[model samples]
Target chain A: MRIWDPSIETLDRVSLRQLQLTRLRETIDRAYHHVPCYRSKFDELGLGPGDFRNLEDLRRFPFTTKEDLRLNYPYGMFAVPMKEVVRIHSSSGTTGKPTVVGYTKKDLESWAQLVSRFMTAAGVTDEDIVHIAFGYGLFTGAFGLHYGAERIGASVIPMSSGNTDKQIMIMQDYRSSALVCTPSYALTIADRMEKTGIDPATLALKVGLFGAEPWSEEMRRELETRLGIVATDNYGLSEIMGPGVAGDCLERCGMHIAEDHFIAEIIDPETLESLPFGEWGELVLTTISKEALPMIRYRTRDITRLHPEPCRCGRTHVRMEKTRGRSDDMLIIKGVNVFPTQVEEILFQAEGCEPHYQLIVDRQDNVDSLTVEVEVNDQIFFDEMKLQRIFIQQLEKKLATGLGVGVRVKLVEPSSIPRFEGKATRVIDRRSR
Target chain B: MKVEQISIFIENKSGRLAEVSRVLGEAKVNIRALSLADTSDFGILRLIVDRTDEARKVLQAHNFTVNKTEVVAVEVPDRPAGLAEILQILDDVQINVEYMYAFVERCSGNAVIIFRFDNVDEAIAALLGRGVNVLKGEQVYEL
Candidate 1:
């Protein structure tokens, strides 16, 4: 197995913690002094950078939630000024505001390096052609993996997401070796190849680096068999540095967190208390080396357990199990994070639409589809069938535009959707994998 | 003369159409004429019933999305070009027929056709002016 940076990845526990302590202190100072959000948070707790005597003392600080990022809006959480920032990425929020993160020149360099570590561990080499299927732009998955592959001196074919037929065409013509995309998308490509009577064995694909959505071991096996490639899972989020935060090292036991750059913590989501190794809990990460945005104990909401035991592959960083599930009700459809509230917001704004609605998510033919079922009311109902269809289609268009993904709006009879007592069950996810 | 037509929205699933019919049947509503328009996802069941308001109220009570629309019923000449002549008369006056369906019962030995037009009043005026018999709401309901 290959390790991108041996000095950091395979550092001894004593030395790694020493490095983490030093970086943690520096990050704390930078965040407390520069970012107003962190500054006030530390001030409210009556703490400062000087109080950090050791790694354990770092827990006294407050945890930053996604709401904090929204509160700050675009650039309020950055420790550096806009002039020093070079790149920007954001995740779509439940409402209109997105959680944005910026990167300085050095930050971007470290990001690529971090990403390269995981891709390298997943068997991507300079001789291999890396085909990235994640869409580029505000979403960090594509650009993060793109730069990381480039850093490894790999020939990158930037085939951004969608156009599955074209993706297969490029894969065949370009003779690409490594496939980078969501696991479901890879399956979609496999389905396309099968329908077109193309054999997977004829392709040159050797490894697949799949992420951005939770997939199963069964799906991994299915993808491996159909695509004839070694499928591996990588984990990351935009709030932290994207894609390179952790990944499997061919061992496939768990994804090794880039502990040198991030300080990973498992905490009970309800009590906000830290959990022991091998216990399932919400993953919280504090950016120790990030320059533009120094995140302090950001709750990832991803539920997983950490394995502190050393792997046969020789990396010392703790390995996290594939995220069992999320601590929240956010749904990942086609790798895009969608909150039920986001769907509700759009439905509420639609005139004559009842507040009663449900979101049905199902994976059909390896592609995720969202169907928004809304209860029909007199205000929106039309006497003519043609007018009713047009109304429903207009609502579908509005939801698609608002959600950034295709959605089918289904009109149900009045009061058909069951009314719940307290928290409403708004989402019905039938995706088996 | 304008006639009342009830339209019910039904999801395209097994037993939905049967459920609508069962509800209307239990309410003792007499269906005079009927048409079904459908897409892959859903269907709209349109009916000219003996009592439009009562049928709609009953369907609504049963959680069906029911709507009432004003359509016109015209007596078509019972010959080969009976329906064509009525349509041509409306088209000559530039009246658009949104949709049309046939009634089961006939009036004065002529075929009674239910027509939903974009402009109901104008369609009735054009047909009545051409000596066409436009059945009143009561007459169609009785037939």
Candidate 2:
């Protein structure tokens, strides 16, 4: 019922900008001096850390992209030495190399504090038992929420992901108070609970924090009803400190960004210039307070607008619209992000598959399903039915493993799918909004 | 001998079949026999036409996916077991039929069954060796 850091969270725009200015100056200096990539980019533009004057100066610098992070690979973007770095996390990439993120000990502390602020804002109390169901290991979602809940003196349940029946059992036995994971997985747990005929009112869950992929308001309504809890969407990306970058504050309005640490801007994706507030455009973030791997003007490719108006909750941070669509070809299926080009890369490299393929995405029974219809060469088409079935199954397995989501592949004869005259229509999303 | 058949992939829409008919009619292509294999999303319009090359070209020019497949054209008498005997011979020989369609010419008592086999060469050889009459490409097209 209390804001974690009231002084910083509710700071007026004048002081917040003053604080951000100091942090941005330090971040820019750290990046230019330590990270070779940042240094070279600045050198190419004939700019330096000293050139940064005010918030508007961010537009003058070139944008950092996912490709740049990948090009740097494991640690090229880190501004601190490995000895000072405490942790590393990565996101799945279309190409073989992934986008790696590093955190110094101070960076970790700040990240945990930011995450704690959002959790508290979402109405999770210290006395509550928080159950973190996001996947562990390489992904940042699970660990970020885990440490934040622990930081706030809440008892944490590190029940990674999967094992639905056991998840339901823990919810009953442990009397978990707050549920944390992707919205889709929360729905999956609700679905399993329904099959087992367990009434959600019998559980102790009161609040849910969901993120890591785009979800719908309708999904929020269903999750709230199914779990008997107030479900709030949290927005974040691995490029910018994971799930605590911004989150809703029990208002069920737009998610409030941790603006003191991360300055956000909405830009026209084509023009790459800042759009007027409240107009939908691609989201770009500049991490002012991040130290180890400080990212300046990182293009997130997520489409949402900023709402700087005063919120009913009294928080001064800007609220971003819940992102339901992205500016890129990224598709969020069952909480996993997939790109059509990624599917193209996998299918094009696999044998017996023609480069021609179409991605059909639909939601059935409240779960997102991806159906990839691919064209097969003449040799496979004429093969026995059993052989064709086997091939399709194998292709489905390969794609599912690559995409980190279940895939259903249907084989069509060569040239059966329509060819577009210009820009090929590779994806058809039939999922009703 | 082998007979060439034109197969066009059609979306399962209301006017798709009519569109195909109009395209072939405009090209002056005579349809000897026709059948449809369909699924929920799409269908394959299989046609044995008087001009196989012209039909395939016209459909392809109209942006339709068209393919030429070789099938066997056999004479089945109008008697009850006439079609059964031909299928029985193939069943006995283990020649799996992928798909088949039939049509009769000019109110003739004999029907020509078009059979698509997995092993087309072996099936043709076995049918010919058994004294079954199989029409050549020209004979079927000229009929």
Candidate 3:
């Protein structure tokens, strides 16, 4: 059995707030003194550290955005100098430039402890051999989990993404007791496992910590059924010091936020005013213990709610619902909110088509139209005219049912569409504003 | 004897045939003979083009995935019993003709029928041994 540090991880509501205030004050002072950007923001706001007495006063601090990080560029936001920085990670800059993050030696240790706490929350122990499939690189996911598993004395198989055959081979050979990867990749592995005649339950996997993308309860149920393991959501970002900010406990309710190292707040995205608990709003995070970069009220842009209710796992860390969608990435098609992942689910369930797809959104006659181009697998073939008509009709109907919006379906030949090994870009918004 | 052919996978949809044809037309590739084999969801568009290599290259360059397949083309007289005689020979040899489509014969008063079989070589041998005129790759391309 895994043990949790209740004193730090499960501080009561009052103590948690007090600890947050102290940390916030110290963090704010450090940022103002070290980071020129934070200093300028404070000067512009005409505020000082004394103004922020508690978590409620966090709003006084100026919000930090991805653009702000880009403005500062590499290492400009560092509270400590370059000599102290130990590790660096970055987000995939699919749209623009990548956001780089840095950490010190103590920061890495703290990150590991937080990740370990997340694993323990999911019932992972030293006996569990964790098969980590998250891609390794400047990306924080692989190393964060690797360090956390090491911290817990668990045997970790660093199986970075792809080579599905090898991943399955090692899983069976090593009898890995746990898995860490994005939920989508987990399903891919599950599908491959089924095809290879290996029962997921028979594998040594007992739990899966899936994150780095927003997924639904329906998806969670599907993953649980396919892998025959308890699937828990782990939430973190490179901006917030990687995976370990929070995770789902054994009860599998909401992910418990690590209130000790980070302070989380729900704010109305439009007004930037704090919202009451349980209200759907934008999530904001502040790194309290970070050395290299101690961000204050960094706007994560992830829409979710926070639940302070005590978890059955006995951890007092406040929990947050799975992120609904990025405020910037959410698509409004035909007056309905459509997520790329939603379209992905429908495509996954569609018959005789590869998962490779692209969604082209165009506007003509002031009406938004969606064109979903899916790659047809080579194994399936049809008589020409009849096949074309039937495929188009079936896909349109399925899209209507799945997304509640009618869409034009284009069936293209396999390998005709672009494939991404990292973050898949499925949406193309071409509507003229 | 030679023949040029283009094999393409197409999903059943309105304007799909027109789109493929338009693409070929835009590329200045002429289709000599064409046939379609389809299922409930999708179809394969097979064509013998005026310039097989050019057509294949143009289609592939435009991101249309296509395949080159060997198909046996037999010259038969443009008479009521022309196809029946060939079918009888194939049936006797237990050669399953997966699909067959008619192509205009360059020689007057005769029609060329393209036969896609489970085993192309065996089908070609059966047709040739039965005194049927089987076109080679060069001959079909020339036609």
* DockQ for all candidate structures vs. native: 0.62, 0.09, 0.17
Candidate ordering by TM-score (highest first):
1, 2, 3
Candidate 1 lDDT over residue span A67-110, tens digit each: 99998998888888899989999887867577899999998999
Candidate 1, residues B1-143: lDDT per residue as tens digits?
79989988887889988887788899998888999998787778899989888899989888888888899999988899989999999999999888888888989999999999999899999999999999999999999
Model 2: per-residue Cα lDDT over B1-143, one tens digit each: 89999877666668878988999999999999988876565566789999999998897777676778899998777788988888888988899998888875722558888898988998988888878888888888888
TM-score of each: 0.94, 0.79, 0.62
lDDT scores for all predictions? Answer: 0.91, 0.85, 0.81
Candidate 3 matches the true fold with a TM-score of: 0.62
Q: Candidate 3's residue-wise lDDT over A1-433, tens digit each? A: 3446777775788988898889888999999999999999999999887787557778777898877888887779999989999888876332234578999999999999999999998889989999999878777889999999999989999999778889999999999999998776787788788888998877899999988766789878988888889999999988889899989888888998989899898999988898988999999999999999898889888899999888777788888998886766556554344556667766766663447788998866334688888776533334334445676687788776666557888777767577778877778878643
The per-candidate count of clashes, in order, stands at: 0, 0, 22
lDDT of 2 at A192: 92
- The best candidate by DockQ is 1
> After superposing candidate 1, which stretches have Cα over 4 Å from the reference?
A195-199
Candidate 2 colliding pairs, count: 0
- Candidates 2 and 3, the one with greater lDDT: 2
Ranking by lDDT: 1, 2, 3
Measured by TM-score, the strongest candidate is: 1
